[model samples]
Target: MNLRVRVVHCACAGGRHWYADIDDADDPQPDDPFWFVDGCATQTQALETACGELLALSDRVVRGDWLPRVLEDA
Candidate 1:
């Protein structure tokens, strides 16, 4: 599975913040809960958060504690 993480800056409600997008390139899904991280104060923070989340997910998958839906059929 291919995963991609991107940090973005957003301006809304008279405030600015950073966010992260985590995309499973091999299994793109709309409205996936794992797809977004919000309310970060900086791009570095967003990126770090995304990486941490990805690492946690990876650990779960490796330990067989979690199974990705896309991989269920495999």
Candidate 2:
């Protein structure tokens, strides 16, 4: 199944990033395991990174290769 995902701009002490997460209401934890582009200087760059990550993730999913299994368990 292709899960719906959301990408948002976020910031931390390390700088800004594009953060992606499954858009599942059942699990709305802010710090939950997610995909992100860290230390990005601009939203545009972060977005680009997020898009690349989404493509890569979709590729893996299509190949039946779910990753970072420890995160799944958490």
Query: Per-candidate RMSD vs. true structure?
Result: 5.2, 3.8
**Candidate number with greatest lDDT:** 1
Which consecutive 10 residues in model 2 have the weakest lDDT in total?
Answer: 19-28
What TM-score do all the candidates reach, one by one?
0.68, 0.57
Clashing pairs in 1: none
> Model 1 segments beyond 4 Å from truth?
27-30, 33-35, 65-74
Pairs of residues clashing in candidate 2: none
Q: Backbone clash tally for model 1?
A: 0
- The lDDT of each candidate is 0.72, 0.58
The best candidate by TM-score is 1
Clashes of each: 0, 0
